[model samples]
Target: MSTRRAFAAACLAACLAACLPWYSVSAQDVRANGQKQPPVSSRGRLPVTGCAGQPISDIIVITQPPFTERLPTRLEWVRRTVRKTHANTRDEVVRRFLLMKIGEACNQIQRAESERILRAQPFLVDARIRVFDDEAGGVRLEVETRDDFSMIFEPTVQSKSPLVRGMRFGDSNLGGSATLAAINWRDGRAYNDVLGVELENYAFGRGRNEFRLSAQRHRFGQDMRLEFVRPYYTDLQRYAWIGSLGGTREPIEFRRGDLPRNALTVRREFANVGAVTRVGPVGRLRLVGASLTREVQRTDEQSLLLTREGVIADTTDVAVPTFRPQRVVRVNALLGVRAIRFVQVQGFDALTGAQDVRVGMQLGLVAGRSILVRQARDRDHFVAANLYGAYGGTRSFVGLQAVTEGRYDRDAKAWDNFVTSGRLAWYFRPAVRQTTVVESEWSAGRDMRVPFQLSLADREGGVMGHRNSRQAGARRLVFRAEQRLVVPTRLNIADVGFAGFAEAGRLWAEQSVPYSISTPWRGAVGVSVLAAVPPRSRRLWRVDFALPVSADPQRRFEVRFSSIDRSRVFWNEPRDVQAGRERTAPSSLFTWP
Candidate 1:
């Protein structure tokens, strides 16, 4: 047999031997209340475990000064050479993103959160913190961080016929100050070209505050955005004050391919301020006030407003008539309240290079009214509620999230439901380097119109095996279960190996569309290869070949490519976390000051 085949045979034998239930429990949970808990499986703890009358020691945080640094690897050097530049992130800059401090009580969850928060920074590769015994009875922690090449210049281009393109220049670390600045361009043929610049200072000198400024030109319109944040400056980090201002002219397209020609134009000028206070230990509450002036320009294109089935002609074969164009300008005020709590479960270490469970949940309420919309407005008053939570453990991961909103129309004296959507994901590792995932998404409401409706299937990759899921739906429910088996590492070429997987999902919708799983349930069996792309640690590249069990001609055996395993939900770039590791689906839009 050839080398690859021989390696495959060896891998299968090794995996077969490694496959039994390897979950051997150890280390019972220890509570800080000085109480001894019962052991697992009806197995009682040995009587008088330690010296009688001895009290359990409490855990406190300590830092071992004189940290050791690992210099950049040769691979990093090669990257800099190729890019024609070199960049290093300073130690102090890494300290700014840490959520922990010296002299505080040691909380494993917080430690994990700190590591995760550190990893979230674009300039850092990862943070590694280790806990050790302290001579003084408290636990001490040592920290080490790996850095990423922080300065980059990106130019986005398109071959053949394309509509949008841009170029960007940025430095994640400027003079070791943890400041980020970028100048970019977003050129479009019909909507006017855009040139923009943005700057952000994570923290200036001795103040624990941050500030940001951005300005852009759209030819027909110019816009600017600014923000100021004072975290610890407000009340020893117990209170925070954040303020922002924005003015912009933007466009909303109506049809998938009818952009520029059929769209609504919007002009917005707004200011927002928020006050935040710590709630107890692991929670926080915030209130915000916002004021804005909004201008909306309407359009009356019959084709643009057509239903999913498209517009139909009259019985006499005459085309339908289009509505008259209308315009509206208004002033609005908004009040928002939000609360967040972090609950950590003592279990496993999966993503953040730390051993602690971090589950997060947030609740939000927003109320808004258009003072000038008066009688002709359908969105005179609005209220919304949002919730988000995610958990990641060494062997498993889960996420639960939802958001709902409603509006009260003064002209009609009635309440209109906007939309409500929720998602649930569960993952488990059946064996080493093996993964299984089950996930579902449900969205429902009366106002689920196009551009705001639920997407039926993900065509970005054939993980769901559905060839066509382009139609949007007012109500949608989709689910999938998939499994993967990784090849042994020894039988690889250049850190490359192959895997076999099978995935199947069903989509349910209100329309009698071809995308629904009710017809065939979108099943697929596939084989794929996963290999580490070096010059970067543990970054992987994947290619899949799938054979669909459906009758859709387009669903036949096809090839798909992705950066990571299709089973993961590591919301950030796959490069953010190590390969074959489980992690929470990150909420990337929000960043801490």
Candidate 2:
């Protein structure tokens, strides 16, 4: 038999064995026998023990330090000293997130919602809620949570001398207040140096609104932003709003055929404000909203043009296009409907921690008109729409989504800058500790703006082995498949796993000014070593070794490392929607199934 076929056979056999009933005495069986069991709970542990309508006598919050009493004797001093320096999350923070209150009837839905809220906090490692029979004829509620080491300091290194290229340092839970403060510094090649600062508060005020501010400065440009939002914290929340102001002034490098040809300085400033309100029932919701936005952009071609060699070049000889300064003010109406549900699972995205999987359907639409325009184009009408649906079961899940956006120019009598994209994904679990995923995506653009052109790069949905090879285009398609297995770990500090993946993609361009077409299909196969620190962090650290599926002797293997899980396409929780932007369907919808 061939080597690849033999490997596949071995994997199949292992999966079959893992799916069998290996444990003779399961947790449910032990409970049936009236035996004392551990307090630890697994994913989706609902409060269904016939305590749904019981009155809550008292509410208790228990916060655990990072290091517990279950350590070895020799490390007692180390654990004690670390605990003394690291502050545990405050009880008030946990209490404010709870939906259940004392003296009120304990509802199972409220208890489940409260647990999900606590688990979503950045400082929390895990959270659990339990109900007990009270001595005074009412049920008592307990909220138990563990804290993570909130301080982070990561550095980027290179193989050459002066190894350190950049670094990021931050505190995710500043003073146990659930506030984030971070700073980043990078050694830029063309820009000389870069520095940035960011601050965010998840619970800003009495209403627990969110606030964020960021600023970055480099030799070539600077960016500054400020935002405040009051999001729907729960499925039944009635109203939400957001406001933001930001601007950017940066040098943009124009490339052709994957080679830098010219550069120009572009300046842009924008202000936006929006609001949304829920109008339908609790399980299925209809959202209505509106936004007003103003934006201005300008290009500076008079500035010295730099060529690929970093030498001043004549402006007349440059091949890059220069857009006229423009200003636009727009008002948009938004509408959406959603009916979604969540299920907690393990060994899917994270090796050990529970991951919330979202399932159901959502649809959204945004229609707007430019009320005012200056300098360049006449008033235009724009529209955007998105649709998403998913189905998740015990052993399998399937999801599909599509998005389209475009604008109609009144003067040109044609569509301008129209773009559309779609994605389909499927996940299957044959064993308790194993998962397999297959995903495909495609995107196309017509009359696209220069700065919005697409590219086939690692960060832009391309093969890992060809990350450094830039293949720009107006249309792209990619297919990916991966299999993951989690290994048992004896240590409590970390969880380890392994993954094997394959990817293939191609790109095509119509107008060749900004990007060139990549006619040949590129493919890669790779293996990854995955590990998560503190086990419950829900963040994977990966090291990948990829090789191109080609016979070219010039191609070599590539090694890449990343902290983000790029393969995860869907999330259980809704992402925060930015002001003046169309809400991402399914991901930003608020509803319960």
Each candidate structure's TM-score, on Cα atoms with residue i matched to residue i, is 0.57, 0.82
lDDT of 2 by residue, 253-307 (tens): 5435434445567777777787789888876888899877676777775535454
lDDT of 1 by residue, 1-593 (tens): 34334334433432342233322111122345955443222113122212222222322212111112222564344444523443344444555555555556666655555665554444444455555544354544545554444454667666655533887777655544556667778764555567766677766553446777776666445566667766421111455556665555543222121121132334554455555444443344443333333323232333332223433322322232232222222333333233333332211112111222235555445555655454334345655555656666657778776656655666668755455666677767656656666777555544221122233234531234554444333455555565555444432122445556666544344432112123345567777776542212123466788777655444556676654322112222111011101111111112221
Worst lDDT window (10 residues) for model 2?
A: 572-581
Please report how far candidate 2 places residue 272 from its true position, in Å. 1.5
Candidate 2, superposed: residue stretches over 4 Å from native? 1-51, 67-85, 258-261, 302-311, 314-318, 373-378, 550-556, 565-593
| Backbone clash pairs in model 1 (N, Cα, C under 3 Å; residues 3+ apart or in different chains), count | 0
Clashing pairs in 2: none
